[model samples]
Target chain A: MRMDKEVVNPIIDTILGSITSGLNSLQASMEPYLPELSWVAYLAFAIYVLIILAGGFMSILCRNLVRAMMGLVLTFLGVAGMYLLLASPFLAFMQLLIYVGAVCVLIFFAIMLTRNVSDGEEAHWPTLGALGYGLLALLAPLGVIGPLIIMHAGKIPVQVPVENPTGELGEGLLSDYVLPFELISIILLVAMAGAVYLAFRGFGPEKSKRHSK
Target chain B: MTTLTFFLLASLLLLAIGLAGLITRRTLVGMLISVELMLNGAGLSIVAAYKSTAASDVLGQLATLFVMGLAAAEATLVLAMILVVHRRFGKVTTKEISLLR
Candidate 1:
């Protein structure tokens, strides 16, 4: 009394097809509201933005240089998160890998080598009157430029449609921007050599002096 | 409500804070940290622009990769300079290294 294999196969196929159709219809119904998804995207963007700002504020306000570096690292991470929200996961990954992983380490090493972190002396370089003048000088440009930028904001076009921009970017870089790219590499190599030479110059004398001290 | 506006505001705030740090901080390392903050702010803006306009997978990413490379190279050079300054002066305080005057 067992059902034929052919009958069972048809029954299974029908069941699976019906389930798929149901899911497809559900997705189709949801398609009309796709633009609303931008709200969620906006929220994610806002949160990351806040994180970055907060980190920047901390970096500035903190008295300890090490704490300031930590804040900078946090800011970089927040920016990376924002990159992810912007749909540039590749940039986000590179941000983490290069800035957080390498640059921060270099900053820390420099801090360790250069500063006596435990020393409690103030590090201000300018007299109060000079600092006041400097602040005024700095603020003057912002006062002039800020309003101009704000007023012109409405006139600026904000949106540009990119067609598979990442792919196009690769093509553009390899094809059109190739020379600049190569030049950047050469500059980096020069910088690397210069840094090595500068760092090695007085290390021996300084180390011996420190040992004798 | 727009991601673009949100990101723009964030970058602006970041830039402002970094600028403040650069102006006020007396330690070379602190100024360097502030510069890093400013760079990150710039990078965020670029990524946001790419994401909104290009809607592409890799273009924004590639730009950021270049930024990262540049940041690394910059950091290495700056850190080396900082170390050299420290060795020559026996201190990294901005106050102590003003021999040019």
Candidate 2:
């Protein structure tokens, strides 16, 4: 009893056809879920935007230096949230750790140390007109450049498969970016030293005067 | 529309406001607050770029780490300086501190 070739070929073909059709339907059923995902993304984005704007406004309008620092913290938090939406959890964590935790704390301490809480004299310059002009100047260029860049971006070819980006980033930093990194470190060191020197300058004289008085 | 773009824009706005404050504020503490705002903006932009590119470069994360380290150092030093300045001048306003003349 030999099996005929024609019979086996049809059976194999039928089975393969059924499997392909099943996969196709499965994909079809999954398509409806994409919009929901997009909507969630949009909602997260809107919230982040609001956070950034509110923070910015607070930093600008608050007269008290401490209040301004609080606003800055809010801004940082909002930015970190945006980072999470962007899909880089590592960066978001860094933002929270550095900007909110360390930097803001430093600003708060600086405010406490320098500000005379009981003194009622204002600490800000009256530059409303100049500030408005500066704001307009900064925003106008961004507004123009943003649209132009967005329009041109569609025609630009996006580099695909960024070629082991993490590895490349490290290599690039150690190799190509080494000079800039070192320079930045030097600058930071200088800033640190300069600030210390400036702060210490009048300390001895001021102490003597206070004691003599 | 993209998450990265949105974040970048937000950071830019923050930076702009910070710059304005830094320029217009006359107190040492007010300047420090402006600096904090600027730093926050930079952090946000880095995170957004990392997230949208979908590339696991982790460079943005590393950069943020460095920024934090710098911020800590900066805060300690700046606060100490502010304390000393206040003690010497009896006031922290930038205008009042200009006694060199």
Go through the candidates in order and give each one's C-alpha lDDT: 0.69, 0.65
Off by over 4 Å in 2: A1-37, A116-131, A137-141, A152-213, B54-56, B98-101
lDDT tens per residue, model 2, A1-213: 888999989999999899878766665676543222344456687887898778877876677666777788788887777766655555566677767776777676676665534343344445778577657745764686566544543232222112233555567668866875776578678767877777676666676786686
Where's the lowest-lDDT run of ten residues in candidate 2 chain A?
A: A154-163
Docking class of 1: acceptable
Candidate 1, lDDT over the whole model: 0.69
Taking the tens digit of each residue's C-alpha lDDT, what string does model 2 give over B1-101? 33344456677777777777776666777777777777777766665555445544456655765666666667667777777768778877788888863
- What are the TM-scores, per candidate, against the unseen true structure? 0.73, 0.67
All-Cα superposition RMSD per candidate: 9.6, 12.1
Q: Go through the candidates in order and give each one's DockQ.
A: 0.43, 0.31
